[model samples]
Target: ESPNDHINSHSINNSINVISDDDVAMEDVIDADDSAAKHEQIIVKWICQRCTLVNSEHSDRCDVCSSPR
Candidate 1:
């Protein structure tokens, strides 16, 4: 086989592996969503010092001004 043919086959194999990995990740995401729906998540609100924009507690920076929290 030519070098080009070998490279093409290798890339095709890699793509197949990536697709399978993505399928597994999707299943995990679905499971996580189901568990999340079963629980109540508390989201704390924070006000930005510079822009006075209200942001979620999970965020490290202000959404409007991009100021660090």
Candidate 2:
């Protein structure tokens, strides 16, 4: 039990890795959620001006008031 005392030293695990400032970029983390919505076929519903009824955009005339588009 002097200055040269030894307790059977050994290694624990691998070396620790560090990331530099130039390693990653902000643009690399782009969101992929909006792409699905953009590719989807969304139906545009229009409101009838005559009776103020909500109708599907596919129909040329209003279903409630029969108003011409």
For each candidate, how many residue pairs have backbone atoms clashing (under 3 Å)?
0, 0
* Per-model CA lDDT versus the true structure: 0.49, 0.48
Model 2: per-residue Cα lDDT over 1-67, one tens digit each = 7755552223222222322232221222212433222222233566677886666667789898799
List candidate 1 segments past 4 Å from native. 1-43
* Per-residue lDDT of 30 in model 2: 19
Instruction: State the displacement of the C-alpha of residue 34, model 2, in Å, after optimal TM-score superposition.
Output: 18
Q: Which stretches of candidate 2 lie over 4 Å from their true place?
A: 1-43
Cα TM-score per model: 0.37, 0.37
Q: Which candidate ranks first by lDDT, i.e. highest? A: 1
Clashing pairs in 1: none
TM-score of 1: 0.37
Deviation from native of the Cα of residue 38 in model 2, angstroms: 15
